[model samples]
Each structure stands twice: as structure tokens, then as C-alpha cells.
Target chain A: MARHVDVGDLVDRARQRQPRAVARLISLVEDASPQLRDVAAALAPHTGRAQVVGLTGSPGVGKSTTTSALVSAYRARGLRVGVLAVDPSSPFSGGALLGDRIRMQDHATDPDVFIRSMATRGHLGGMAWATPQALRVLDAAGFDVVLIETVGVGQSEVDVVALADTTLVLLAPGMGDGIQAAKAGILEIADVFVVNKADRDGAETTVRELKYMISLGRREVRGASWRQPICKTVAARAEGVEEVVAAVAEHRRWTESHGEFAERRRHRARTEVEAIALESLRARLSARHGEALDGLAGKVMAGDLDPYAAADSLIADIKAEG
Target chain B: MARHVDVGDLVDRARQRQPRAVARLISLVEDASPQLRDVAAALAPHTGRAQVVGLTGSPGVGKSTTTSALVSAYRARGLRVGVLAVDPSSPFSGGALLGDRIRMQDHATDPDVFIRSMATRGHLGGMAWATPQALRVLDAAGFDVVLIETVGVGQSEVDVVALADTTLVLLAPGMGDGIQAAKAGILEIADVFVVNKADRDGAETTVRELKYMISLGRREVRGASWRQPICKTVAARAEGVEEVVAAVAEHRRWTESHGEFAERRRHRARTEVEAIALESLRARLSARHGEALDGLAGKVMAGDLDPYAAADSLIADIKAEG
Candidate 1:
């Protein structure tokens, strides 16, 4: 029966600003149904319409509080906001602790704000296959801005969040080498850095360390003027939240004015589409030539041609046969 | 020129106990050459001749010290030992900090000891793709026991370590909630557990937590009598190293007595062979059918069909063409 639901109807209901309909569509996408993939493809045009702000850092960082504050700030200006919190819990568990959601309860009845927690679902490379799907749903549901907060500082999670329009990396004080998380891989990708819990001891030191790290990685592209911004915040008390919001607004304006936004979006589109293509090809190849692969593999194992050449020959044969 | 080197000469040198030749072959495997893969394949039958022990845990768990102590204990018993420390550092540097090497310096010049540090290069998975090649080299080098210590603990690194004959997960005191790393993914993969740095506080609590976690995950399968053993060690001081070694010996005996060794080795072989085959197919597909792939991908992204179905259809077409 769920399969019989026309993806078109779901998309239409979502576009009509029906929250339940959008939520249902998101569930379908999370399930990764073949039919829903079609719906998502159809719905993508509605996306690239929302300002995607990504938040990522170590687990204990107050990303949730910062996101909550941002949501309030966006709504206070009469803007509808969607928070797509990518929790690291297992989807098989069917739901997260929803701790991030609980923190955003101030907007529970706002109707102008939508808060949804997404599980990473153990997807390879960190971004859930369902993430793009969720983004589409939120876009169709009439959100002005989408805030995506992910769990950890690993390379894969950072890569996923880097797909966002404005990637904000959050840090906290006393993370003793917590800057290591940023310096390792995530720092280079961030558009805005936030030293959350700025009231804590060593907050100044953390900020300085992050500042030093950022400056170290910076290079002068003589003709182009682009410098990633850093902000400090005591997110729990909402101090400096306005500064972060303003920074994001400034970054957005700069990107739009410089035409960098369109270029970045196009680049992301091409990469995502290509990834889809590669996944498709791999699937096809595996299915069509399973046994031949096994046989050829045995030969390769037994003093045959190099794996690369064997692959080339197989592809040639496949193409010739086609 | 490098490919023309005779395998027999290399193998003869290795058999005659030449570490230089063994190191050269290991480097050859690390290069991931098709010819080297073929040579390693031919050498597979002569492999599984060494007791391969995998040491893994969170970073700073004193895995190196535990491994060093374990090696020292084995050598004290007159066993020929080889250490393959798989470092996930930059290969271009071609130098290890030798933190673990420092601990094991007593055996650096020992005639029966061969220690090699393998750097991760171009391997999609955590372990070096040339790991099997290195193992074969170590085997031919006549080492009775080859200890492969994988640096760091993540899903892929743990999987690589699990490939060993006996996987030992080392933990340390003050690893509060760090045991969460074990309760979930890497711990279940352990055949033997070693609590290193037991001299630190919370040692007793760490032990209790592991026991609880292990017991929770244990399956009482009918007709199967294997139980994973946990040992606490102050490896820096060589305390409890002998017990960890004894547990390892016991696990080996249990595996052999139950004929699990042959089955595990067979599974490993199948995995290695399949990887080789798929890798070969990927290269072949990319080179010969690269344009066809581009065409199909364009169509798929242009909203033609579901990628999985497109994949299915492509496979059918390939099989039909074949």
C-alpha cells in the first residue's frame, strides 16, 4: 500500500505546504525506495531554494544549542526555518534519543519552524542517501533556511556537511587538543568557525588556536577576495548568536554578490550527479557479470594479468558485447 | 625494470632469512603492482604458515607496548618473530616515529626478528591493499608468529585487524566511556582482549564494563564452545603480558581443535580473491566502456529511470550481449 502511494501526490502535498505530507515523504526517502528516488529527483528543483547552513563539531560541543538559537533568530525575523539534525544513532533503532530535538522545543509550536532529526544510518561516506531526499522535502515545505547539524568530526561527516552552502564548525573550551579535530580535516572546509561556550575558561585560548590554525591554512589568491570568518558564542545563553547569524548573512550576501554561490551549487550538483552515476554503474557491472568475475578473479589469482588490465579487458569485452 | 625481478630468487632469499629481500618484496607488494599481486597469489599456498596476531584499539591505548611485550614474551620462548606494524601515515615521508619500535628496540638487531612498518597508501579500506603481499613475504621469511598492529581503531581499521588469525583489542584505564568504542563495534570482533595501562585509575571499572558488554553480546550457539578471553595488562612494565599470550595460544588451540582455522582461512582467501577480481573489473570497465558509462549516466541523471533498475537493466543487457 505504501508502494502504491503516487510519489507525485506526495510531492504535490509537500509543495502545498502540508507538514505531515512532507514528513511522510521524508520517511519514504529514508526508506530508500526505488519509487521515492524518482519522487526525490522530481522534487530536487524545489531544492537549491533554501539556504543550507551545516553545523558540525565534536559530540559535546553545543551545536544543538547553537542551532536552536539560530532557529529562534531566523523565526523572530518572521522566517520559516527547517532544522535537519543528522544524528549519529542507528536508524534500525527507528529513532534517536532526540536530544537535539528536545533542545529545540522552544520552537515546537511555532509552525513557522520544522525540526527533524535524521540518523546517519551507517551510510558509507557519512551523508545518508536519504539526506538529499530530506532536503528536498524541507525545501518543498516552504523553509527559508535549513540547518543540518551532524554528530562527529570525522573526515566522512565533515565531507557530508561540507556539501552545505555555509558550513559552520563549532568548538568548545577545554577540548584539550579538540582543535586537532578541526586541524585534521574539517577546518579547511569550514566557512564559519564558532567557539561555543565562550564563557568557559580557556575559551580565549581555543579561539586563538583556531584563529592560528585558520591563518596557517589561508593562502592569498591575488585577484579573488575571500576570507573565511570566525565567530565566538556562548550558545547556551544566546550570546554572540546574532554575530554568527550576521556572519552567515554576510557570507550569503558575498557569495551571491560574487556569483560564487551559483558556481558552488553547480559544482555540488555535478559531483552528486556523478556519484549517483558511478553507484549505478557499479551495481550494474556486479549483477551482469558475477560468475565471469569469479572465474576471471581465479585466473588473476593464479598468475594472470594485472587486476587493472584484467578490469580493462573485462570492460572492453562488456562494451563490445553491448 | 622492477617487475622483472624473479620471484624464486626473492623467495629463496626470504627462505634463507634475509630481511632485506623480505623488505624489498614487502615494498613490491605495497606498490600494488599486478605482477606483485600475481607473485603474492602464487605464494598464497605457502602462506597461513605463520600465526598472525592483530592488535587494535583506540589510539593511545598502549597497543604498541602490549604488542612489544607480547613479542618479547614470544621471543623469550625461542620463537622466530616478525612484526608488521601497519601505520596509516603518509607514505611519502617513508619514516615512522617508531614509538612502538622504540619499545621493541631490544629485538631490533636480533637475528630471528624481522620488523616492518607498512604505511597505508591508496587502499580504500583501512589496511594497506598490499597487506596480503606483506604477509606472504613474512611467511616466506620463516617467522613463526607475525604480529600486525593496526594503528587507531575505526570500522575499517578494525575490519582489517579482524582478518588476522587472532584479533586482540587493547584498552586502557581512564578510558571512561571510551569502552563505548568496544561495547559497540570493535570489541565484538576481538578474540582476546587486553586492558593495557591497567596501572591507571578506573582499571577495575574498565574490566567490569568490558565483561558486561562482552556478556551482553555473547551468543550461546549450540555445538559451539568458543569464548572470547579478556586479560588485563600493564604492558609498559611487562605485567600480564604472559597471560595475554597464554590466552592467545588458547584461542589458537580452540580454533584448530574445532577446525575453525581452515574455515576462517578459506573465508579470508575468498575475500582476497574477490577483491582482486572486482578491482580488476573496475579498471577494465573504466577504460573500455568509459564513454558508454558516461552516456548511460547522462541518461540516468536526465531523469530516465531508477538507478537500481537502470543498473538491473544494464546488467541484463550485458549478460544478453555476453
Candidate 2:
């Protein structure tokens, strides 16, 4: 783990589409290596070229199948693709991550497709915190497109919308997903919606419900020109997948023309920068005021002070020291 | 929101078991109010008398039903109970919160029982970040027990363990939850297991399978005094819920005797205080260096600086400004 890392050399190889180099760079991100700045520095010049698409939905909605099919769809156009999966149930967390590289196995041997899992495993931060940096890694690696997939659980799916240029919210019929899509607050986040497993019963009803929901929610995004599209697909059979591809491309065009593209990139950059700085500040506080924090936590534990007041005292002590 | 808040008076009323006062205090926590520190200061003296319990698992494992039953069991013994739910599918997260107060309706009129949902709906942080404050509110308000229920998704369930004294992981048969429990990194987090809906087919299989998984995972916790128990429950009928209550009490006794109880409280305090300080520092950095962050973010957006280097530059600027 302490070996000297030649970040520049790795970036060069990754840009050349050398698969191992791409995987190694992502490992550095996943591992939170000391050379992360060097790697990010080296990769920055080559980024902002790839399209980042986020795919998210409830479990059992065929998210993995849709991701695999989308990979194939992109590859059909001779485009190189990269996938970064961080979902708990996705091919990512532990033994399941390795064993169930699952449907993504279809493109395992393709030199043009790179699939890597960013396991938090209690690393520096969470899926939301690590994603932008990973996206930048793939973006700079010369992948024509990168698809980021996360399970639609709680705040995670909402975070995906921040890291992606175009976000797809997937649903299947009979999952009561239309109401779920509304409830999860994902209706406003999606750039496109994919109704996978469309061959299943009640597909039409799900699609219609989503369409009506879209119309209802459209007023909120009045100035935003990209109308979220509903693409129906039997992803298991690869039916209607190309239309999703077409829909994503159309979304990219709208974002690019409307200034939303660069704005989204800036927002992503702001989040990544702020998170890194916040983590650095947190480390500094703990290291310099370890005893102060212990005393404060003890005070809170003993009911001598509330957590917020202790927090204020700790910050004041830090400032007073200066 | 702009009205002057009488924090001390409110805390007095809440501790006196005035329902609206209790509800008002939690809303302050939920809203991340400016008066939070004052509220916390007032509540601190009344804290630490309540036991905190965490109820979590995959959706549809009858968590609400089990929770309602547990409230009844505890109320029968003349103990007041408070429930804080943050799960998206649970009686929280929007209309579902007010709409599907669901099985909890049984306890709606029971003044001795209180249920509140902490909605993150784009508030300060995710459920993980906001839960401790909410728990503190419940604890100081004189509830005998606080049950924090979050959807078992990714990192949120793990967060619950850090907040709970006795964490119950629930599962329904035929849901493949046995495997999910292991894969989701929750097997090690459970203090007790509940197989709810025990009348259904495969209930025995689920319980047996969980026991096997727990045994396999137990070696890691080497010297822990508490042996994780599997309690079979048909919560809808309140069957076997007493065993769960008994198990929770027994586990509490072990922790209180073994110093684990105090240690857990210390850890929770440390997390809460640090989060508050970190958030304060984040606000400071953004307030003082908004333009600098914008400049660094633009550099990253333009591929001139990687996010980490930009982060470093921003930090250096902050120190220089000081």
C-alpha cells in the first residue's frame, strides 16, 4: 500500500484506454491514497470530455440488467464505456460485489468497457462523497461515456443526480414505482425515466402514470427545456434499449445548448472541492483539539452541556488558540 | 419560524409530558433551528434517563406493526415510548408520513405513546446526520424509550446501530433477507433479530438461516457479553413481542453492567458534537471564501486544477486570510 505511485504515468495509460491503468486509478480513489491529489491533478487536463449518466431505481427494478443493456447499446455505436457501481445490492459492497459482478459480466472481457465498484467499506466518506472524484477519473480516462449506478435508497439516489450529467430513474410495472418515484423525490431529479421489464404485466399503466406525474411535476421545472422522457424497455431482452440511448443523447444536446451542461459541471466541481476541504478541516480539528473534543463529548455525555453548545465551545477554543 | 422561541419554557413543558411541547421541540431539531443550541442547553439537564432502541430492516418486514406492538407492551408496564422514523417507505418522507401513519394509527390516540418522523427533505443532512439530535429531543422529553427506525439501505442502517443501545434487525420469510442481511453489512450490527410475520411459510427457515449467519458473524465480536437473540414474532397480532421486550431489557442490563452502555453514549456524543462543529466550520469556510471557492471550482471545471489541489489552495487561502 505504501509503494510509490507514478500518477502521471497511470493517467497517460488510462487516457490510452489501457484497462488496467484505469482500474488502478480508480483503486487509488477507492483507497483514498496519498497520491490522490497527484492523480487528480494529472487527470484534470483530460476530463470534461466524457458523458456521465446516472441510473438509479428501487431494487428489483432490473437496474443491473438495464445498466448492462445500456453498456451494450453504447458499445454498438463503437463508444468506449466505463461503469462505477456503488450500490449495496449492486455488484459492489463485499463478497456480493465480487461474486455478483452479475449482469455486468457480459462486458467483462471487452477492452472498451471498464466496470469498477467504489466500495466505501468505511473509507473517508460515502457513495455521495466519493462519486464525483471517481467520475472525474473515468471522465479523464478517455471513456466516451460513463454510467454511474446506485440503488435508489433514501438519499443516495438523490445524490446521484448531483454527480451525473444526465440521470435516469428506472421503474417497472406493478412495483407501485410511480407513486414511489413521486414519494422518493426522484421525480424532479431525473433527466430521463426508464421503465424496464416493460414486458411485465401493467407496463402501460406504469408508463401512463409516470407520464401524468411528469406533467404534474413539469411546472416546477418551467425554465428547464429538457423534458424528462419515459423510455420503455425489456432490458433483459435488449428491446427498446437504443431508444434510451437516443433519449440520453438528446438530453446531452439540450444541456449543452441551454448552458445547463457547464453549469452542472461547475456544480459537481464545487461539491467535490467543498467536500475535500470539509474533510481536511475535520481532520485538523480532531488532531489539534483531540483533548478538547474528548472533554466536550464527556461533558455532553454527563449532561453538562448540549451537543450544539459543546460544538460551539470546541470551535471557539480552536479560534482562541490562533 | 421568525417568532421568538422560549427554549427554557418549551423544555420545561416537554419534560412535563405536554404532547405539543414535545412535538414542537422535535420540529426544532427537524428544522435545524437557529435556537437549537439554546434548546439543547435547556434539554441537557433532563437527558440520559431514556433507553434508545433502533428498529430497522428491509421494507415490509412489519417494522411499523412490530413497533406499534412494542409500544403497547411497554405502555402496559406504564412506560412512555417515542418513535422516530426516517425511512422513506415508512410513515415519513411526505404524504406517506401523514397518510400511512399505518399500523401506528392504533397508538395515535395513546397520549403515552409518541411517534415522529424526521424528514430530511433537503434539510441540513441525511437521516444519519440528523438522528442524534432528534434522539436527544426525545430523551430529554422524558420518554422511557426511543425507537429510531430507518430503512435498511446502505449506510443508514449502520448509522442506526451507532445511535441505538439495542438494535433489532427484522426480517420476513421468503424475502431472501437472510442473504441481504449479510451482504448489506447488517449481520454484525444487530443486537437482536426479529422474524416478524412468523405465521407465514418459511418462517422457520428464515429464523434458522439467520441464527446460522449470526453464529458465523459472531466470532468477530470476540468478547462481547451480549449474545444476539433471534425472536420470532407475529407482530400484527402482538404475538411473541413480549420476548423481544424481554430481550431488549436483558441486553440493556448487560451493557449497563459491562460499561458498553456508557461507551456507546460517549461515542454517540462524540459523533454529534463533531458533526455540529464540522458543519459550523463548513459554513465558515463558505461564508469567508465563497469567491475563492468559486475561483477554485472554476479552475477544476476548466480542467486546470484537480479538486484536491483546488481544495488545498482554498484551505491555504483561508489560513492566509486569517
Candidate 3:
């Protein structure tokens, strides 16, 4: 099955902006193929040149429309653009968000733009593990700006913020959002705010709520030197999109000046390394622990042993076997 | 502040059917308090007596209405029941699902019924790790049956299926669900199907869809001896609830006679024990891996070291240190 992919040749083709090569590289990352190690080695040097921006918000906040607008904005500047529509499908629902692809058809015929819809397949934490790799593939392929849009303002949204240098938290007018969905964590991660569908009612109030939340967040000592700007857009018409582009560029300049840009990237790399290492360790313990855990599970099920004690025995076996 | 509280005393109170004690024990499990090992050891012996049922579906499928109906049915049978309404709130939305609580107000004052709504606290995998502990607390406290209902038909629903002795997958009329949300995995886990909101426009169509999906599922190697019966219900009025309750009872009898009861419990215990052990191993690696991984991450960011190489070095450090 294409297991014998030449990593170097693929990276070379991707660097020349071959869309299929880029797709193949990203597929390796998504599938967790064995060649990922080699792909990473080949792609690493060419990454870190692209600017990563994450767009996240509640469903119906016009994320796809906004993403299309942003792609048009960046492409006008003569820069290649890459889009990852990361759908956090209900693990059972197999809900692939196929309709989103229809919305992005505007860019389908453009050679300079790569539009992809990726599902969080198999595991709850699957996207977190695979997304950075996909970003690396895009980055190495020389996409000047990569826009990552995730559906829903859930854990996946927060994860998108971690992967991006600048995060745009979008909201639609008339939603009467209480910032309750921002959960205390997203308030810390959002770099810029975008009020999409601003032509509708309550747009000003949504901006007011975001402003109030930002002021409240400032008191808690976040990027104190950089003030985040709020931009309004009717992305369906590409109205006020340039203002968002300006805001992102401004945020980038501020972060670079404050050294927060490098710090964020380094921090992201640390998380990436730790996750990969932890997964490796987990795999090492799995085979040996399987049979013993089955027996211990039976004991616990019968009320003959507690779970905590059984867990200890399982971990203790790992040490003894090693 | 309650650090010095005696685990044995709490267990004693919980066993006497004290709602406060049951609530307190669940809080410990939710908060992951230091006394958990003691609480788990104490509760393990008294567990294994409760029938755990999981009710999950897409939002607005009348899960709470059905839950309330089931609670009434079980109470009429003179059984004390515990309801763990596990709300998998969007990690950012802080969405607590408070409205569902109001629906269950009918049984709020009854000493025989205890209802609690728990948020997926911090981690993405938080629900999977904590739900079982909460179930054990309720099981140990002598509840005849425990209903575990989650917000969405996502990963949390699948987790509920793993925890449930009988899983009721509910669907509403006119939703046109293609078993797409069931995602192949839930179809294998659902023991009983309920077409809720039967008084609505498309109830019969929903039931027919379920039957078709079940028949399609039967062609595979799943529960060959048991043909899952779909009961149409307007749970808001408790119509047709008795049939659904009878279906669950029949399921319990089948699982018990077929030995799937012990097997499922054993499988769940194995998963629980593995999660706890992995968490333990993860903690042991954290302190040491933190400093080294930070430096490696810097290199990875600088492109001098690829992430895979950095991860390998980090894991090697673990083996060397241990």
C-alpha cells in the first residue's frame, strides 16, 4: 500500500508546490504512517516560515465563509494559502461535515490555494497529535499563510489556538453570547476577535461583550504589552476582511516585538515532543501489560480487588518487566 | 479544607443512603482528590450490585424526558436510583447543560432519587477517566440502578456504552439520521433502541430507519441471539415507557445468561485500570521530562532537531533515569 514512499522525493516535490505531494505528506501525518518519522526529518528544515492563524467559534458563526474570505485576502497579496477545516466529528456520529466542502468550492480551482477538510478520526485526542504534522507539511510546501478552522467552540477550538500564533474567535450577530462558551480557558488563548455576520442585529453588543471580556482578561496578566483589536465582517460578501488581515498582521508584529512569537512556537514544540514521547512510552507498556490487566480487571469486576490497587499492579509490572 | 475527613466515615454515610454522602463521594471522584485511592479501595467491595444504564443521543432527542420517565418507572418498582447526567460541555463554552436539570425537577425532592450534572472538568479525556469512579461511588452507595446520560452522541456516548449494562440509543422523528451519528461503533453497543418524541411528525419513519439500521447491523457478528426491539415513546408524557423498561430488563437477563455481563464489566475494568496506570506513569515522567523536553523543543523550533528525534531522545532519557 504505498508504504515505500520516498520521504525526500515527496518533500522535494512539496517544496516545488505540487499539491498532490503536499496532500500525500499530510495523508502520512493523518494516517499515522510509519514514514512520518522520515517525513518529519525531511520537512522540518523548511517549516517555521509560514504564519499559522486559527479561526474558531460556535457553529453558524460563519467560520467557513470567513476562511474563504481570508484565503482570497491572502491570495491577493500573491502568497500561497493553505486551509485545514478541522471538523471535530462526534466520535460515533462519523459526521464528516461534508457540507463545509461545498462552501469552500470557490478555491477548488485555484492552484495557489489548498483546501482540505480533515475529520478528527479514531481517537478523542487524534487531532492534537496529527494537526501539527499536517501544518508542517503545509509549511514546508511554502504556503505563506495557513488558516486552520475548527467547527464548534469545544476542546478542539482550544487546541486550534495552541497550534496558531494568532487566533481569531469569531461570533455572529444576534447570538446573545454570554462568553459562557469561551469557558475561562479560551479567553486566555484568543489573540484577536472577529464579529462575523455583523450586518445582522446585536453586532455592536457582541463586540461590547468581547471588549468587556478582554478588559477583564487583561486584569489577569495576559500579553500585557499587546492589545487585541476586534474586527467586524460579513464574510459572505468579503466585507471588512482586510481589517481582519490588518489586525492579524498587527498582532503578529506585536508578538514578534514582545518575543511572544518565538516563545509560543517553542512552547508548542515542547508539547509536540512530550506528546510523541508519551505515546511512545505508552506503546512500550501496552503489549506486556495486556494479559496481566485482563486478569486484574476480572478480579476488580468480581469485587475481589480495587481499581487503584489493580492499576498499581499494572504499573508495577511495567517496571518489573523492564 | 476537608483534607482530614475520614474516608471510612464517608463510606459509612453513603451506604446508609445519605444523599449528602453520595454527593460528597462523587465530588471526590470529580475533583480527583488525594483521598481517592482510599475512597476507591473502600467503595470497590460494595460495588458490582448496581445495574448501570446509559441513555445518550443527539441534543433535543428527549434524553432528559426519557430519563425522567425511566426514573419514575424504576421508583414505582421500589428501587432507589442514581442519575449521573454527565454533561460533556464544550471545553470553552462552559456550557453546563443547566436546562436539562429543570426537566428532571419532578424527582428532585425524592430521597430515593439523586440527580447530579457533572462537567467534563479539565482534560479532553476527563469524562472517560472520571465517569467510572462516579459510577462506583453510586454503586457502592446501594443504588439499584444508575442512569448515565451524556450531552451528545460523541465520544462520551461511546464511553457511556462501555459503562452501561444496557444502553438506550434514542432518536427523534424527522431528523433523517442515517445512522451516520451512530458511526458504526454505537450500533454495536446499543442494546435497546427507543424512537422518542413519537407524537411528532416523523416518529414511524425514525423507527423504520432504526429497524433498517439494526437489520444491516445484524448481518455483522454482533449480539446474534438478541434482536433489539425499538419502542416508540413520547417520553414527555411517559407514553410507551413501560415497554422500553421491559426491553432493558430483558437485555439484562440475556447478558447475564450469556455471560456478557461479566465480560463487559471485566472489559470496562481493564480500560479503567489502564487509564489510571497510564496517568500514574505519565506523572512519574512529567517532572524529569519537563526540563529536558523544554531544551529539545527549543532545538525542534530552531529546526536543528526534528520532533521525532527529539521525542526519541526524551523517551531514552526516561529509560536512562528509571
Candidate 4:
């Protein structure tokens, strides 16, 4: 629309502590517009200043509560923090439901803590295409730490963990049948594991189950305790809350010492750039050959030819058109 | 890599009854290679011939059982059916962990049925990228109906259903939390609502809750029956399986009569192509610039500038190099 926003200018404006510029930069990356992707690419160097922690769990497992507690812990340590709470968007409205964001009001009045609610707008990618870009904005915004909370415990939610330096998976007692969180990929990548709502029944059983599951799947990496620590917490009561925070800090130390933190972030950066580049390119191709593609689609629908063959012809046609 | 495998040749071989050809065709689409996107564009027109039915629910809702029963019912009707059992990939091994393919035991030896289990392999779009091409392959391979079973409930799973002609959402009894599925976007896309494991306790209550939620959320659409039918079934016993099949057919009939089926399928086809194009472009860009991008990422980690600004420089450098 306006030759797309320059990622560099967006980054510069965001550097100047401009909210609208930060929002615009996130939009550019999320939309994966060609111009915006370019800008995001330019801003990629300023990331890694902040420690990224991913918080994920089954819905209603007190992930928000845990995130709120984590924010408080960081604030108590006199550290600035940013929380990117990802919420599911209504398919009909394409807006965030914001149900979980209501639980994160403890830090609303604290200027040191910045929280943003994002909706996964069915943007081909489960997370809005711009999420990594948004994270970069948070990274550059001078926050000492940024915590990403996924909407749910699905594959896309798992991807959110991959984008973080330390992933903390929150689990609750008596949630579902005996299916452990690791079985769903939640327990696999977690640098630290947290069992929230420990005041409930089956807390011991849940802890035992998580321990067993982690033992079954734990990978031994050099110089780092890959053993996913089990921290019990009653989030609402703030009981054992500081222990979870300590576990996160311990994890950061282990990752940094083992040099895995920089390695993982580098890989994530590559993945983010690659994914955005592809999304942008595809949008471009779709706009150019949409009509010819429609014509071919009509012919295939008429039962004149099969889809594979039809695809072949269309590719040739697109090449010729180009 | 051999010019990325010719889409037409692969299609022709597949049409000529070559099994490996079909497998390779699927691999192409799954990889979302630049060449395969073209193949998918050509394949979309021939897709509407098959009845694309989507099955989704929360993890461990007996969704796999329900899908198995429905596939068995459709096969008994003398229809050639293709089952795409989508499961989450193991985070460690990057493959199907529980072996979803083995779960469809009844269809194993039936020539008229083709069963395939797919996992989301850390792709930004996950199964969304591979689904349409996979469906097109099955459609062109002469399957009368294609069933898509998603791994988890949320927006991505809902997107899978939106691409289908009929969507059946399964809920098991005793899950007081099934209402969360409705709130999370599963209820809106359901052509047929299924309360699976009807033999269990609280089945009736689950159905009542679903009905209540549906009633509250239902909106009137012109010539569209937004009344999602709640069908109960004991999947383990294969009881009430026929009614589920009947409901799917009934929904198909109504949509066809109102011309919504054809239109939705058309929209789905185009969207599928767009997804492929984007994924392909991503794959290509990632391949070409992955290492150079990684080099820039090292500096980003060292905090030379903001990550956003770093990304901008990398994108510009890549464009200039090209």
C-alpha cells in the first residue's frame, strides 16, 4: 500500500520508544508483506538482548497465572519484562478472544512490564506470520526478558516454544486422562517444567507422571541439565512461585553456559526469516496469476481433466505468462 | 535436485496406477517445494470430485476411534475412501510417535481404502501446508471420499475443517471441558456435531452443553443450515456409526442443493494453492540464504543493533545479492 513500511525506519522509530511505530513494525512482519519482511530482516541484528521464555500448557492450566507470577518475580528483581500473550482469534471476527489476558492485570500499572495480547488470525501459519517480528520488537524495546505464552497445547503452540530460549511447560493435576504433557510435545522441549495448581488432588500423581515421562524422553546434552525440572506451584496463592522463577534463571544459566542459548536463537532467527520470505513470495504469485488459475479451475471442475494433470498445465501456463 | 521433480510427470505416473508415483507426489506437496506448488495449482480443479470430510477434537477425545468408525462405515457403502489421519509429530524424532497409521487397522487390507498418517514437521504452517496437495493426490487417485482427521483442537484444526465439505467434531463423555472446544472455534465449523463414546457417563450432559453452546452462538446464514446436528456414537462398539455417516451425507446434500458446497470447495481450493505458493517460496528462500542469514544472526546475538534492524539489513543484502 505505501511501498510497504521500511523495516529499518520501523525499528528506528521503535527504538525511539514509539508505540505506534512498534505496532506498525509488528504489523509489517506479521503480514509478511515484501516490504515489511525486508524491514524485519534489517532489524534482525538487534534481537537476543532479551531472554525469551515460552510458557505453554493445556487451556486453564493457570498459564496466565504463572506468567503473571513470573512477571512479578522479574519485576521484584528490578528487571524490565515484556509478555506476549497469544490468544485464539475467532474465525468469524479474526480478533483475539482475550479471555486469558484478563488474568494478567497484576502488572498493568507497572511501566516496567509491557504486555501485549496477540490473536492467531488463521494467517495460514497458526501464529500470525508476524509473531517473530513482534518478538524482535520486544527484544529491541529494551526489555531484559520477554515471555511468550501460547494459546494452547497443539503443534503450532509447540512452534512457539521453538522460538524461545527457555520453554517452561505448565501442567495441572487431574486435567485430562493419564496423557502426559510430553506425549503432546509440551514436555519435550521444556528447559524447565512447572506443575501448577499443586494444591489440587493428584498433584503427587501428576508430578510422578511428569517425572516418569521426562525420564523416558530426556536427552542428555553436554554441559547442560536437559532434565526438565518439575516445579510445583499453587499459582493463585503465589505459593512456590519464586521456585519456578529460580528454575527459569537456573535454566538460563545452563543454556548460556552450554552455549545452547545462542545456538537455538540463531536457528530460530533463520527459521523466522525463511518462513516470512516464503509467505511474502507466495502472496505475490497469487495476486499475479489469480485469474488464469481461476479459468483452469473452472475447466477442472467441469470434469474435463484430473487435478494433477490440470496442475501441470497451469504451471506451464504460469511459466509462459511470466 | 533433478529440477525439483516434474509435476506433470509425477501426475501422469500417478494416474497410470503407480503407487510409488503417488507417494512421491505426496512427498513433493508435503515438502512444499517451489515446483510442487505449481503441481498443486494444477491439481485444485479436480479436487471437488471427492467428498472432503474433516474430523477434529481435543486430544484423547476418541477422535481416532470415531474417525476409524466413520471410515469403516463409508467403506461398507462401497465407496472408495482415503483417510488422512493427521497426528502431531514427535518433537525428538520428528516422526509419528504413536503410529496413527496402525490405528486404522480395519482399512489396512482394503484396496478400496487408502489410509495415511501425516505429522506436522515444524513447518510454520504445519499440516496446513501439506493438506491440500495430499487431498488432491487422493482425489485424483480415484478416492470417492477423503477424510481429514486433525491432531488437536484450535484454530489450525478449524482451518483444516474449513477446507472440507463436511466437518465432524467429536467429544467424549466426562470431559466437562468439552465446552472449551466450542469456545475455541471447533463448534462453528462443524457440519455435524458428534458426541463420541456415548456409552460413557455424562454423555447426555456433554450433548446438552454442546447444544446450548450452539444455540447461543448460532447465526442465520442465507440458504445455509447453520443448525449443526449433534450425533452420538460409541466408536469402540461402532454403534450409531450409520447415523454419523448419514448426517455427513445430509449436510453434503443440503450444501450442494444450496450451492454452498461447491463455493466453499472452490474457496478452499484457492486458499490451498495460496498456502502452497507461500510455503514453496519460503522453502526456496530458506535454502538459498540460510547460511548467510545465519552469519548475520551471529552478530544479532552479540547485540550489535536491534534484531529488527539486523533483519532489515539481511533482507536488503539478500535482495541485492539476487
| Cα lDDT computed for each candidate against the true fold | 0.65, 0.77, 0.77, 0.69
Report interface Cα RMSD per prediction.
Answer: 6.6, 4.2, 4.8, 4.9
Residue-level lDDT of model 2, residues A206-315, one tens digit each, is: 99989887877676652355788899999999999999999999998988888898888887888778878877777767788888888899999999988888888877
Off by over 4 Å in 3: A1-3, A57-69, A88-98, A117-121, A153-157, A168-259, A320-322, B57-73, B87-108, B119-121, B153-161, B168-260
Q: Higher TM-score: candidate 2 or 4?
A: 2
What TM-score does chain B get in every candidate?
A: 0.85, 0.91, 0.91, 0.85
Q: Using DockQ as the measure, which candidate wins? A: 2
- Estimate the TM-score of every prediction: 0.73, 0.90, 0.81, 0.82
In the range A128-219, model 1's lDDT, one tens digit per residue, is 34565587678767789999877543333544575578889887775433334432245656778888888988888887877776665565
DockQ of 3: 0.32
Best by TM-score: 2
TM-score result, candidate 2: 0.90
C-alpha DockQ for predicted model 1: 0.15
Candidate 1: tens digits of C-alpha lDDT, residues B278-316: 444434344555565555555443445333444444444
Candidate numbers, best lDDT first, in rank order: 2, 3, 4, 1
Score residue B15 of candidate 1 by CA lDDT.
Answer: 80
DockQ of each: 0.15, 0.43, 0.32, 0.27
> Between candidates 1 and 2, which one is better according to lDDT?
2
| Chain A TM-score from candidate 4 | 0.84
Location of the lowest summed lDDT over 10 successive residues in candidate 2 chain B: B89-98
Tell me the tens digit of each residue's lDDT in model 4 across A206-261: 88877766665556322345566889999888888899888888888888787887
lDDT at B315, model 1: 46
Please provide, for model 3 over B46-119, each residue's C-alpha lDDT reduced to its tens digit, 9 standing for 90 to 100: 98999999987644567888999999999999999999877654433343444566788899899999888776
Q: Show the lowest summed lDDT stretch of 10 residues, model 1 chain A.
A: A89-98
